[model samples]
Target: MTAPLSRYERVARKVQADGRVPALSVALHRADREPWAFTVGESGNAAHPLGPETRFRIGSVTKTFTAVLVMQARDEGLIDLDKPVSAYLDVPAHGDATLRRLLSHTAGYQREPYGDVWDTLITPDAAKLVAELDRAERVLPNARRFHYSNLGLAVLGQLVAKVRGGTWEQVLDEYVLTPLGLRATTVTTPRQAAIGYVVDAYSDAARPEPPIELAGVAPAAQLWSTASDMAKWAAFLASPERIDPDGRVLAAATLDEMRWPLTTTDETLWGAGFGLGLILVPEGRRVVHVGHDGAMPGFLAGVYGRRGGEGNPGALGCAVLGSSGGAGQINELVHELLRLAVELDPAEIRPWRIAPPAPTAYRSVLGRWWSEGSEFVFAWHDGRLEARLADAPADRPPAVFAPLPDRPDVLRTVSGRETGELLRLTRDDSGEVVRMHWATYRFRRFQDGFDGGPASAGPEPVPAG
Candidate 1:
């Protein structure tokens, strides 16, 4: 018997009908709450009603899992993102394309192996795959643009296999899936799984798609998962630290690196971009989503979560699974649910609290100053010295500095436009700061009617107390 319809159930029904898919499932997750899931329509030729436990091939979403292993290898100092993959693997010469480029699909690798691998539903083994590397030519120069390449991820998988001394499947289970408690996500299709189909373009009829087993290229698109397990995965992606407090799976900062944009899919559409094995979807100026979409011969999947950049524990996610290929409605449905989640209840903003008092020496550096007639301010936050244009937006990051361990007065810009530059404080005979030089610009205390403008170079007067 069908269960009572929930809000999510209604949306899932609409999505299945609109996409003309044989079966569809959706899940929504939020922090500190149980996930809401719904499944509608039939599975395979049996007309069996689909349920939340029914697994479906997650396709290229597997790349994100492979990416996590690569990142873990990097954390262990076994791999370098800037170095060429050839330095670590025994693949054909790929010029100077780096590991970072491969993960971002900017390495310009051939989209697939030689011959009719896609049509034949056959992929080469490791030896056969490497032997054909010479035929895998670069379609464009490295970092030319956002190009999708399944071959690059397959190479990454091989690297993981080599470094861990285990199969890619085993390493993933040890490093990611097991740690996250995603029991239903497996490399092989489960017994209770949805049958993939290709819907006819001009009619309501559809044809079952023969399952293709990805041998060497399993890293590209070969994982099946249920909505119940995917909900847990989505929650982890939404906020890894909260979900994995022990950092057993991946470090919080490294996860942020994966979300950083490497390139844009379309130049005109700035809202859509690609990160390291992940997709970036901009909701507004403040909220950005980081996840991946997947599609194979007949299955489609999407997983997205809000990435709250600023100390905001932005925790919300949506996952969708469909049993039809080329439905072209998965992304739309996922986006709608994401928007709805945000609209219903926004992320909480923590209350402001006072930071520990600055050191006696650093206390003197706090307050407003003028640089080239432009107002600027230097203040202490969490024991660090940060400066920014006085008129800058409140939410924007500022140029932060750290005191040189050897020389307390000499500060180094750690982040922002002046990163890596030195800031030497100029003090008067009385040891009161008169002016300061950062890079090539000098800043002096702003005083009444001090229209001294910008001093290209000069010994500015110390502000009178």
Candidate 2:
């Protein structure tokens, strides 16, 4: 988006003032605009101001990275989403939890690894985690509901290590960090890391929080990164089709699968949902923000991305990291940045241009057809034969069809209405399409009753292209 930097800076400054955070770093990324980053608050050193490159622990946002790793394993045919994770790892408890459940927080695994790890700040290593698996309880039945569980993801990390024959950290570095050039995102503490703090409830005093090693459960929440790196990572999550065209990490189709909402995070409001590993938040019509939010003892982060709405918001990403923990401001700030970018200045609209005509076979079927008492408009758009109800919502996608190989008259609805159903075309002796059947329902150029009677004559079809 072409959103003004001053506008973002104003929001950043306001968020910093409202939270009284020690340090706040925000970054925005769009394909057509230069990356924009803003940092405000104390930098300790006057010579070096805190900036986007300064690392802050991202806590549960690391779950998103781990989720990608599991998807990669699936892409390589090493893991199956439907199979029980025990099919890969011989964990003592919750062996029946499927990989999909684990990824989507539907596994019913308890919130943690059977201990007060958060209170003690004493996370176990991989070995200890597996040995004590029996201690972890299944709080809910498998696939019961969306119960956020770090333990579930921790076990998945081990699953990746087991199937890949390496440590989770090592496998992650080799598979994701190194490949994505996310050198700043790592388990080890970086020299430029920002110290986290717990601001006093009554006073303005901020006490530094201790940094603990999440050795065993690190996959769920251990990595540290700057807003800049995380913004690009968020961009990849939302628009893998544009960012990772090579599919080195995961295919665009796999990313599509990941974005599909499976469980709602908020039961009452239904405002947000959980995808495979991503959190899906609907912003508005045809625009859903995909990413994750994280918080630890002293640090909080919000990293999210919104795909190009056919250029209205053109592949956008934002990351907001704060040094103070328990501050909802950090997460809200990131979302505000995204909203401002989309509303203030989306990508400039491209002038309409023309190319390539519809195929001869589809030309006859491309017009207006009536089916089930509804008028449908058909046309070849974006190289696909698509149809939609006359009164369909503007935001709803049309039913797009692809011809079956060697079956000239048959087409499959790959997406939109009646998906996976077939559209069969009937031809007359003159090679003109007479009528059609979609999803076993008859469609005709003229409105007709099912009882072999004319209902009413509608408008005539336009001449074929």
Candidate 3:
């Protein structure tokens, strides 16, 4: 047993003592380093020991992979995120539902396609699945709410098939699994797969449950993989350079966009918000790409990665799979492992540090400036000037400014790409700044003998194309 195992063993013993689960599997990886795998208890039958190679159903976690493929199609110009799903697939859209809305779970579709849960061991094919669309059309009225819908994801699968000119399973096999060298990963049934099991709520005992087959909603939850392969997938998400095998799976920019928050939901409390498919977590001082969690009839899993290239000194990632139905506990365990990984080696996952503030001698430039029809305040903080619009929205924060290069009369918006100039500070015999020129607009200090306040608020001058 390894020293880390001694620590992990204590955790496993505590889990067993709670009697919530009977088995667990975990895998950890860092850039340019081999992954660490651990298992406790019998995975399914109490006779077979779970190992790094053990496969498990990755429920909703499959959505992250599917989202990645959609991003790939978008990057290749084969599909547009803004386009309507009906544009690609012949699906009927009762309202103005677009692919972006569907991807972000804002389509307002019913939570589930069928009113009741279907047997996972027996699922319908794509064509048979589409026949149920009539019922799916009666989704909620307000499409902006974050309502997770399995039917909405099924529609996304249909779109992928239509755009890629193949079935969703075929697209996953050809574009994602094959390119990433995930030979053991697939949307279809495997020859040697781990049987799912659910813990008895009353007895606190475990029993094997039939595999939750998802032929119709495969895009939403049919993926299956071992901890080892999932480690590679997590590493790819954390360190983009390490696992983008042929550069065809997903572009770096598109991947970055996928990590960007499209919306925030109440289901998870982690970070800025949910992106295309992955969950964002505030780990320590920096945000990290925490993998999605999966829960099937008898299986549960979790995966996570760093936010940049593997070359980044401390990039780290991990994957965990188990043959238990209660995934919430396993998810918490993965987070604990992540915390330990960073704490054990701070240098490997250190938070980004901002550079120290520089000295600025222009302290007089900071003050409240008022013009007719407009009143704004400027203050200096951390060696930078900040501007606050008195009448702006409550959620919008103040804007920061930096000094213009080789120009004392100009200040640039710290968050903007362009610079603004403070041309001249007009003065009278009394030596008071009665008027000033900013950019091309003129501003009067609000004293009696000055021109009108600021110029008319028209569109800023734009360069000709």
Candidate 4:
């Protein structure tokens, strides 16, 4: 191909040509390569082209930053996620609603604080917002369901500000943005930021959306960032160890805790769930992407990064920003970007090499075998006995088993199907591996009767008595 359109370029072109968004920019980051980015359409008007640095309101994605601060406070013993917000700040009812409940949107708090501010396009002062908390009715029992509470996150912002003895914005800069080198991300729209617009649903015309300043609710939906800056944030979410390295911002383990799903709204929707602060997404159990999405009056933004499992440990991420809201394309576009990246540019598989001499007991069973007419491979990889279906799809990784210390012929599945199940190897009279039992199912080697199939070229099966 002479000049193939890159994945980013193709997505950006599709986003722009859709004509729903006035401006769009997207970026993709993989651990092994530099980030790829593309932009199309105008930032403010028909002439100015949207670029990688063009900032857009990242609405509720601000909540993820706010949640990180809450988690940091928890790690420092400043706040307990299991304790009540009233234990930390001035709130009357819902004292039974724990910080964990609030963070995960299970606190049963009203979605918004008591106010006509949304209609007025104005947010109330902290004092007024707190004074109205008594009016926030609990629609559901505490920790019962996934009811998103903007007020709950605002209360968290207040907790951060109160604990740090600084404004929430200051604490955010000191604890997250500055530490992460997200220089362009800001609480207020920067001069280079694109102006938000709402495209008419019925016509091609669009109207400018008024700038809304979220005073007390800033933590819930008030931040502006570019795709470039957000790509860094996504990378950090995917693998904080590589990004932070020194734990200056947050530890890798703490980040992992954030990805653990706290609750889900429905049983049928396994793809969506709420974590401590991040989002837990299982893309058909093949891959799980963790991140957040944001939407304001006229802007939409999304940032998702792969939380790899099943032998896919590489870090990959995508960030999408659009100046037009209600188009619903940014979310889809960001997801496609991640899926394509994983499909086309997966991490290089570690080359297989001979392992050091295994213990005398393990040497006998570590090799190719057959189970249920399917070829299975058992080899020592990275110091563990890994078993894989030889004809397994490329996307599927092997089942890893850790040998039992007391018994050499026994192993336990640690990180795949039949996890925690014991694998007991059986030996013949001559001490050669005859077959293995896993989850009460027999697995025999190719030479071991082939599970009593047609006669093998190797040895004849000893008939059962």
Instruction: Give the whole-model CA lDDT for all candidates, comma-separated.
Output: 0.81, 0.88, 0.66, 0.81
TM-score of each predicted structure versus truth:
0.86, 0.94, 0.71, 0.79
Give lDDT tens digits, candidate 4, residues 114-140: 866678888866666777788878989
Q: Which ten residues in a row have the lowest lDDT in candidate 1?
A: 1-10
Give the runs in model 3 whose Cα sits over 4 Å from its true position.
16-19, 45-49, 119-122, 267-272, 308-315, 348-465
Comparing 1 and 2 by TM-score, which wins?
A: 2
Best by lDDT: 2
- Residue 394 of model 1 has an lDDT of 75
Across residues 1-465, which tens digit of lDDT does each residue of candidate 2 receive? 234788999999999999988899999988788888989987443455687678888999999999999999999999999999779877787799999999999999899986899889898999899888889999999988899999999999988888999999999999988887888898998878888899998999988899898999998999999898898898889887667879888898888899989999878988999999899988767888899999988899999998535454455889999999967899998888988886777788877789699989888998899977789999998898999998888778899999899997999998889989999999999889988999999999877888645686545889999
Stretches off by above 4 angstroms in model 1 are 1-9, 45-49, 309-313, 353-356, 381-386, 398-440, 447-465
What CA root-mean-square deviation does each model show from the true structure? 5.2, 4.9, 9.9, 6.1
C-alpha lDDT of candidate 3 relative to the true structure: 0.66
Better of 1 and 2 by lDDT: 2
lDDT of 1 by residue, 272-328 (tens): 888888888887646777788999888899888876544333556778999999887
Candidate 2 Cα misplacement greater than 4 A, ranges: 1-3, 43-49, 308-311, 457-465
Off-target runs (Cα >4 Å) in candidate 4 are 1-5, 45-49, 309-313, 355-465
How would you encode candidate 3's per-residue C-alpha lDDT over 273-322 as one tens digit per residue?
Answer: 56776776655333465567777787778787765322334346677777
Best by TM-score: 2
